[model samples]
Target: MGARRGFQEAVLAIVKKIPPGKTLSYKDVAGRAGNPHAYRAVGSILNRYDAKKWHIPCHRVVRSDLPAPRPGLYFVYAVLCGNGAIYIGQTGNLQKRWMQHRNGTASDYTRRYGARQLFHYEQHGSREEAVQREKWLKTGFGRKWLKREWKAGRTRQAGGTPGGYRWGSKRKLHLLKKEGAL
Candidate 1:
């Protein structure tokens, strides 16, 4: 237990040093933590990390095959619109793009639907990579995966309408399993 805690602490320290908007793969993190073969262990530690108790930026550690390339500023973002629609997009500057959507200057669709909240985002290392990821997220399978993975709660409206889209059905779970993301 002591050794496990020490390893977790070391991993967290390395993660904390990652600059904002940049990412390190699990393998890279493990190597930095002084155990080149402990990539999966590094991922386990990060997954179990207590964000409230520790200020480590665990989000910076991602899978090596993540769509992002190395060395640049880009992001793939997802927003839940007011009318129960999800919008996926990519940008070099996330804050600026989000503000544009909020301020009604992003696009006809977003302006008409009204962007409600930022539901998910992933940092990329270049504009090209961001665009590729954005394209993938717009696909049918990717959309389904996002819905199943990031379902959020919504308030009950008048007329007994169902709030929030529920993607926890068995079929969706099966699909996630097939994709090996579960």
Candidate 2:
């Protein structure tokens, strides 16, 4: 437990050094945390930490490449608009991006439609991959897949702001597979 706590502190310290709008790869974070080969463990530490409680910027840690192979870094996300439309996007930082949408800084479309809930999302390896996936999700076939796969009733309520929704385990795993995110 002492060793785990030490690693957590090291990870948190490194994460806090990441500036807003900037990011570090999990491997990079692990190296800085004094264990060059602990990239996966670094990711686990970040995932387990409560960013809200500690003011740690876990979102700043991404995969070394675009569209990460695992499902813990960058993402392609779908937001349910108040007008019943779905908005697709990609981001290295999910929490920050959601905040931007809620605050009207993300896009004109989201501002106009009003983001009501988080409908779907898939993790990617890197920013480039996430961008590509976001493009696909905006296409007709992708839209059809989303409509068929997404259960509107299962979407977590947004409550008029970002940061209110947490991903349910089953839905998250299902989306990862359906979107070829693995």
lDDT of every predicted structure (CA atoms): 0.63, 0.65
Query: What global local distance difference test value does model 1 have?
Result: 0.63
lDDT of 2 by residue, 1-182 (tens): 98778877888899998765444557678888888788889877767767678787665555442222345478788887768999888877765576566545689987776665565667777788888888988999989888877755543333222111123445433432243221
For each candidate in turn, the TM-score is 0.45, 0.46
Question: Which ranges of candidate 1 are over 4 A from the true structure?
Answer: 1-71, 152-182
Which residue pairs clash within candidate 2? 66-125, 66-126, 67-124, 67-125, 67-126, 68-124, 68-125, 68-126
Cα error of candidate 2 at position 61, Å: 25
Worst 10 residues of 1 by lDDT: 156-165
Worst 10 residues of 2 by lDDT: 157-166
